[model samples]
Target: MNIRQDDPAAPHVSGLLAFHLEELRGVMGEHAFALDASGLSSPDVTFWTAWREDELAGFAALKHLGAGLGEVKSMRAAPSARGSGVGRALMDHVIAEARQRGYRELYLETGTAPLHEPAIGLYRRSGFVNCAAFADYQPSPHNQFMVLAL
Candidate 1:
């Protein structure tokens, strides 16, 4: 798979971004934290798309949180790409980028719902450990926070 920094607003990414947001909202309702295209396009965020030849396989983003800190955001593998290592590849790419940017810690917030189990497992396997809420997030039963010290 080839991974490259990408624009969320590009035609190639719009459909997947819409689907990702819709699915997250369907699963978590108001508690969903996945960003929309506008959010991912913020100046502090760097987005990437994973491609298998001409097909878009997945996407993920890293948000600079200032002071050597970074947050993982908008990680989603296409339905057709799930279970084929796309998620792992995206996670690895984001982590490597965080390290390269001199971040001392990488953080992420995900849901506690069953729909999130696979992602939580992936995060754990990638070295993230449970942590208290960070940044602007409030502690809640619906939210699970994790961090990896770089």
Candidate 2:
């Protein structure tokens, strides 16, 4: 899969954020989405979608934490694309871009649910270690944090 910057007009990005907005809320509830630590709307944040052939498979975003740290945001793979390595491809793309841009480490906060284990595992196998929440995030019973060196 290939990763590309999100284009608001693209069928992928056009509705993708709206979809994740709802899903994220469902996963973490209203309080967390309001934080937007995910930075989905920040102009400085980078949104990328994975594409294979002519189809968009999944999406991920990187949010700058302003201390050589980065956060993973909006990581989701299409139902048909799950378990097919689409999520990993998106993650690898973001990690490579982060390294290229000199980010010293990457971090993320995800829901503590069985549905999230695969994503957590993906990060673990990619070299990330469990960590306390970074940036402005406070500890949450619903969320788990992780970090990785660049």
Candidate 3:
């Protein structure tokens, strides 16, 4: 597997990331929480793309939220790449990258639905624990917040 930082605005990355956003919208309906294309390109955000051979496995991003904190955003494994370790690899990379950026902690918001269990398990295995909302996010029945001290 090859993982590298890339411009989320690039055609290929943008298209795949857009698919991820759309998938979230479908799953969460009016409560989808993904950042849009331009938001991914913000100065404080770092986007990463993963590939196995010539296949685009998936992508994830880290958003610096100031005060020694960072947020995990837009983590998605392509449908074909599910169960292939793409999500785990991408998550490990994000965690490491957040540490490298000097963040004291990393946080994320995911859904509480059964459809989100796999992701919750992923974060749990990665050392994240459930927490109250952070940044601009407000507490909501549809959202589950998690945090990892780095």
Candidate 4:
């Protein structure tokens, strides 16, 4: 798989992005934290897409939160790409990029629903440990916060 920097507004990414947002909204309702295209396009966020030859496999983003801190955002593997290592590849790419940028830590917020177990497992396997809320997020039973010290 080839992972490269991407534009959230690119036509090729619209379908998966919409699916990702819709799924998150369905699962988390008002608490969904996944970014829409406009949000991902912010100056502090960097997005990337994983491709398998001609097909878009998955996407993830990293947000710079100042002071050597970074947050993982908008991570999703296409339905067709799930269980094929796409998520792992995208995650590895994000973590590597954060380290490259000199971040001392990486953080993320995800849902606590059963549907989120797979992702939570992935994060755990990647060295993230549960933590209290950071940044502007408030404490919520529906939210799980995690961090990895780089």
Candidate 5:
């Protein structure tokens, strides 16, 4: 598997993103949480994609929030890519990019669900711990917040 920075609008990036959202709807029973794929397509955001044998597996984006802070958006792997380290690979790439860019911290909002447990574990293992909400997101029973200090 290979993970690197890329344009979020690339055909593979878009497909992984849609696949991620569709899976979210299935797990959350609705489109409760959405990754702003459009924002990822912006030039202001730093995006990354993970590939395995040239197949699009997952992608992540860092939306610059100024003052060495960034929000991790649109980090997800296709269903077939889950549990195969694609998510971790993408996250590691994004987090490292954040630190390299001199960000003090990285934050994210994910779902709170039995199905989301694996993702929760992934974040924690990557040095993220529970944190208060950041950016425009507010406290909601459906969302879980975490941050990692670089």
Candidate 6:
């Protein structure tokens, strides 16, 4: 698989992103969608897309938060691409990008439900540790926060 920073507005990327949002809505409800800023135009944010040969494999984003901080957002592995290392590769790309941008820390938010276990495991294995809520997030039973010092 190959991963590269890409435009989210591309046709295939946009469709898969919609699919990701639908999946999130089904599992986490509308409140889960509240923090999404994927559709907005922001100079501080960048989107990455993963591909296997010609197929779109997955996508994730990094949002710059200044002060040597960065946030991970909209990470999604295509259902067909799960377990084939798409998520891991995307994460590796994000981490390297954050470091290249001079970020001293990287943070992310995922859910606490069983459905999120795989992702949490991935983050943990990638050197992230559990942490209190940061940025604009509030404490909530359904949310799990994590941070990694770069």
Question: Which has the greatest TM-score?
Answer: 4
Local accuracy of candidate 2 as per-residue lDDT tens digits, 71-95:
8777888766889999888888889
Predicted candidate 4 versus true structure: per-residue lDDT over 1-150, tens digit per residue: 999998999999999999999998998898898999999999999999999999999999999999999999999999999999999998999999999999999999999999899999999999999999999998777898999999
Candidate 2 — worst ten consecutive residues by lDDT sum? 30-39
Which is better, 3 or 5, measured by TM-score?
3
Candidates in descending TM-score order: 4, 1, 3, 6, 5, 2
Winner on TM-score (2 vs 5): 5
**Against the true structure, what is every candidate's RMSD?**
0.7, 2.6, 1.2, 0.6, 2.0, 1.7
Each prediction's number of clashing residue pairs: 0, 0, 0, 0, 0, 0
Candidate 2 — what's its lDDT? 0.76
Q: List candidate 6 stretches off by more than 4 Å.
A: 33-41
Candidate 3, 1-150: lDDT as tens digits: 999898888887767887877777887877778888788888989888899898888999999999989999989888899899999999999998888889999999999878788888999999999999988888778888999999
Worst 10-residue stretch by lDDT in candidate 5? 28-37
Model 5 steric clash pairs: none
Q: Give the clashing residue pairs of candidate 2, or none.
A: none
Model 6: per-residue Cα lDDT over 2-41, one tens digit each: 7877877777776787787777777777446322444523
As a whole number from 0 to 100, the lDDT of residue 68 in candidate 4 is 100
Candidate 1 versus the native: TM-score?
0.98
What ranges in model 4 sit over 4 Å off? none
TM-score of each: 0.98, 0.86, 0.94, 0.98, 0.88, 0.92
Residue 63, candidate 5: Cα error in Å is: 1.3
Better of 1 and 5 by TM-score: 1
Lowest lDDT 10-mer window, candidate 1?
A: 27-36
